[model samples]
Target: SELHEKVKLHYNNFKGDPKDVKEMKERIEIEDE
Candidate 1:
């Protein structure tokens, strides 16, 4: 599916901005916890 591919692409290309990546991970962890 396009959605699955897009997600994988985002993860692969996510090193564009360090702060953005860090914030995203923090948010995801907070939600999971």
Candidate 2:
């Protein structure tokens, strides 16, 4: 749950920037693997 919270915080930090959000999503996906 802590990881999820961290991810949420990251999302908030990247909010309103589609490019950053996309990069974040890619990073998360790689981490998931």
Candidate 3:
């Protein structure tokens, strides 16, 4: 759960730029596979 919290924190920290957030989500999806 720590990793999930960290990811959430990181996502929240980057909540300003939509482009970067979208890219981050895409990268996370790729890494999931």
Candidate 4:
């Protein structure tokens, strides 16, 4: 569940940053493919 853990860490770091979360989401999606 590495991806899950990465998501959790991203959440922790992006708690108050929607911009960062969005960027991270895009990066994660790219990595997923």
lDDT of 3 by residue, 1-33 (tens): 567667757877885679989988787666555
* Model 2 RMSD in angstroms: 2.5
Candidate 2 CA-lDDT value? 0.76
Worst 10 contiguous positions by lDDT, candidate 3:
24-33
Model 4 lDDT tens row, 1-33: 697678767766776668878887787777766
> Where does candidate 2 stray beyond 4 Å?
1-14
* TM-scores of the candidates in the order shown: 0.52, 0.57, 0.57, 0.56
Put down candidate 1 lDDT per residue, 1-33, tens digits, no spaces. Answer: 565556556656787688888776665556544
Instruction: Name the candidate that leads on lDDT.
Output: 2
List candidate 3 segments past 4 Å from native.
Answer: 1-5
- Order the candidates by lDDT, highest first: 2, 4, 3, 1
lDDT of 2 by residue, 1-33 (tens): 579669868777775679879888888767766
Scored by lDDT, model 3 comes in at 0.73
lDDT of each prediction vs. the true structure? 0.65, 0.76, 0.73, 0.74
- What is the overall TM-score of model 2 with all chains considered together? 0.57
What is the RMSD of candidate 3? 2.4
